[model samples]
Target: MIDMTTGNPGKLITRFALPLLLGNILQQTYNIVDSIVVGNFIGSEALAAVGNSGIIIFLLISMFAGIGMGAVILVSQFFGAKQEEKLRTAVDTIYIGMSVAALIITLCGIGAAEPFLRLMHTPEGATMEMSVTYVRTIFLGTAMSFGYNINASILQGIGDSKSPLLFLSIATVLNIVLDLLFVTVFDMGVFGVALATIIAQGTSFIFGAVYINRKIKIFRLFSHRMRFDSRILLQSFQIGLPAGIQNLLFCVGTIVLQRLVNSYGPAFMAGYSATNKIDMFVFMPILSFANAITTYVGQNVGAKNLDRVKEGVRSALIISVSTAIIMSILVTIFGRYLLMAFTQDAEVIKTGEEFIKRLMPGYFLLAIIFTLNSTVRGAGETFMPMLASFVSLLVARVPLAYLFNYIGGRYNIFWCYGAGWFAGSLIIVSYYLSGRWKNKAFRFVEEAEKPKR
Candidate 1:
């Protein structure tokens, strides 16, 4: 594992962020391939079905993964303090907590697939049917997906970003091949794409587990008790529950935005899905750097290196904003070509282009918000960012979306994107500049009296 506590802040952060950026880009690429294959092979209706299910899936996945992220903060802090025993306990507790949560969420998701689709206002017939099928298939594999994500979070917490990247690269290739085989060769339709994803996720989880077992003695899964520790469990929920709720808030706002989009029909749905995929790619680098800042700040905060932590945040901002500007230019220039890879339909292409033109330029604001939140999050100040997200999503974005739709109809929908970014960025920046996170950084338990596991 790379120790981020020392070394040049820019160089260390850049080195750490590159692998994460590549992995996220590959992940987004494979996701786009799912849409492309479904659109070309199964038809736009199938594409719409998958697209409509995206926010619901995000909401579930993010909620489960958020708790794991909290545990990760603990792991980073403990690891940075060189508290081996506490780090082990944190890992074990996270594994136990996340596994149970994943199982419960899977059951709930499978049982409520139809209701969720209906809630999203998915049209009846094939669109609704395929959506239900796709959601159920994906939900069935939540254990594997959550396992991979939680494990990855633990690795990231300790500054081992490369291994997850390697695992994700393997999984991305597997997912792409399976997507083509299932959809094109076997004609599995929407079910095929979902199955491909699950199998790939399971494979990645297995690989990550093996790596952790071999490389890190503390993460030995079978040797440790799967039972939760009361203190650790409570701490995990304290940090993670709010983060999960933050994710839910963002996704709920997304689902709300999607419902507005769905009212325009399948053509718009397909187009919006395509653009959203590209949007993820465009900001992947910024988000990756933001995450790197979290780990970087996390370890330094644990080590009580306040100066280094502050330096990391400043360096990350420069890197994130510059990268965002470059991406915006690239997307503006080559976006049409990217959209063409997804579909040949003229209407779909036009709608996607419009969405890109409307939203891509505002990514500079997104970079600022993401970087600042990640820094604060690493300092273990999760609640402030969570509240900021609620304000941005509930207080600012949702109402603006409805108002825009009322005033200008379909064309005005893009207005919500800019308003949300600006509001979230402003709120987070204000909090970060207030310097409260510095006080929240040091909460380390003394290593002398370690709890028995």
Candidate 2:
């Protein structure tokens, strides 16, 4: 784990963010590959089916994904304060709790799959059937998904991004091979897409487990010394619940928007899905810096180096905003090619081109939201950042999407994204400048001076 509290802010961020950026890129690429194989080999209807279930899966996953973010906050602080024992405890507790939680969530997800799709007014006939099948299959692998994310979060919490990067790299390549094998060779259809992802995620979890056993002496599974600790679990959820709620609410807003998108039919759904895959890559590099800042700020906050934390935030903004601007231009230029990479259908490509044009230009605006929110979340001041998501989704994005859909029709639905980004960024930036997060950040190190259990 790297000590981020002592380095030059720019260099520290760069060093920390590159691995995360590449890992995120690879993750998104594999996701894109799934769409490519599904869209090309299976058909646009299958692509829409996958897209139709995307928000539901995310909504379910967000229930515990936020806990991983919380783990990072606590783990980074413990590492920063040199509380090795507490750090290990936090890691072990998070893993155990998430494993159990994953099982519950999986059961809930599979049970709720059809109802959730029905509520979303998922397209009828093949689209609805495929969506249900894909989600149920993916839900079955929820434990593996949770395992990989929790372990990776533990790695990131201690400022070791490279281990997760290595594991993800292996999974990405394996996922592609499996995608082709299942979808093209075996003709398994949408179920193939879900199965490939599960296999890759399960493999990555195994790799992470092996690496931890070998390298992290403190993280052995089921060691008599490594029993569960309720306090650490509470601490993790305390910080993580807001993040989980934010993602849940954020997905809630997307589900709302998605229902509207569904109104436009399967063609638009396939188009939007294709563009969404490309969009993940677009924001990923900038968001990686945001994630890096979270670790940097978490360590600094724990060390009580508030000034250094401030400097790190500023440095991250500079790098992230610059990168966003560059990416915006590139996406505008090559948006068509990116869309074409997913599907060859003329209508899908044209619809995606329009969405990309409206959306990519505002990514620079969204960069501020990501960076500021990450900084605050790292400091354990997640409520306000969580509030920003509510504003972005409910107060701004969803309403705008519906209004546009009612008045201007299909294309104007894209404008809501830019509007939401601008509004959310403004709210988060105002909070950052108000300097309230400094007040909210708990002295985690001081509080946990005496390790529990």
Candidate 3:
């Protein structure tokens, strides 16, 4: 049996995080490949066009993924508690994913794709039409992204992280192959790049849906209704709503920051984008452990094994701290080479180097922050991470960026983002230490489910 409900904490965390790390690495292979193709083939401007859309990109994907997190939290708990019926009931959660918000965001995102690029002051020489192609293409594929996230989340919720990773690996390879073929053979540029990603993700969506249908033995899901169930919908929304909102708010804040990066022109845009890539490298392993903790914490909490949750958190802390230190050193030392991987432009390289040095120190704090938040959330403590991000992102980061950009030069923009990460980390640290989330329970989901009269 694939038991996520009980296990040794240290062994559990390692087992879970390793596959998660591999999954993340595979996922990133798409981006790294895209960057090299876009940078070398179309030029830095094309890279910036893609880079400039980071907010819209993150907003769309993260929003649904956030909802996925909700399912993970609830289903993990149910599975841990050995409540098979509740687990089956939760299958309806997919409806929360197919929302009006998805439509609204996609339309607005596609519509604003070009204008937003212009707002960033995209250099005419580099970004002409490329931004539009990149943003519009990504927005068009939101439905595929939605499906993939839902299917994958369902698998992850039951502690089958490797299952999602398996299909995702296939998709990642297809994406790269298509990216090279389109960009190289067809001479398609950004549009080719964008199309490749959508097709790849769409392919993954198909594979995941088919795989789950054949493998996961949920009755209502596989037999009863090919339609959305109110009970399942309610549970899905109950879990996904807050996470969705949090990611939306966070993405909005990133848009504010993206606008600031825009003002620096394409060279700076490329530099800062490279820095963002570096940040992801830092985020992956910590994220790996954090993701594990959610399952570890969620299942254990459901099984009423609070002791295991505590122990897993400790193991996560040691792993996270060590990884953070190592990544910071690697980033600090190889920052230039990494930047060079994206663009050979001397000006962009210099700017990327400068931006990275400023952000390196904060990686350690972020390592703790991400792990703690994920652990808490996995333990069913959503509010703290939500509250922490809300305050730090909207209240601190946005306003601070405005202030710094107005008074200081471009360097202040980088600092503004760093400061928000720093502040959010502190808030998360305080919240984790408080032990309040430990007392809270995920009652929203259970109450949301009702029988048809």
lDDT of each: 0.86, 0.88, 0.77
Root-mean-square deviation (CA) per prediction: 1.7, 1.3, 2.6
Per-residue lDDT of 336-369 in model 1, one digit per residue for the tens?
Answer: 9999998998988888988888787788988998
Order the candidates by TM-score, highest first — what do you get? 2, 1, 3
lDDT of 2 by residue, 383-445 (tens): 988999889889999999989878988888999999998888888999999998888675566
Best by lDDT: 2
Model 1 TM-score, all chains together: 0.97
The TM-score leader among the candidates is 2
Give the residue spans of candidate 2 off by over 4 A.
Answer: 450-453
Alpha carbon lDDT at 427, candidate 1 = 84
Per model, how many backbone clashes are there? Answer: 0, 0, 0
Candidate 3: C-alpha lDDT: 0.77
TM-score winner between candidates 1 and 3: 1
> What is the alpha-carbon lDDT of model 2 when measured against the actual structure?
0.88
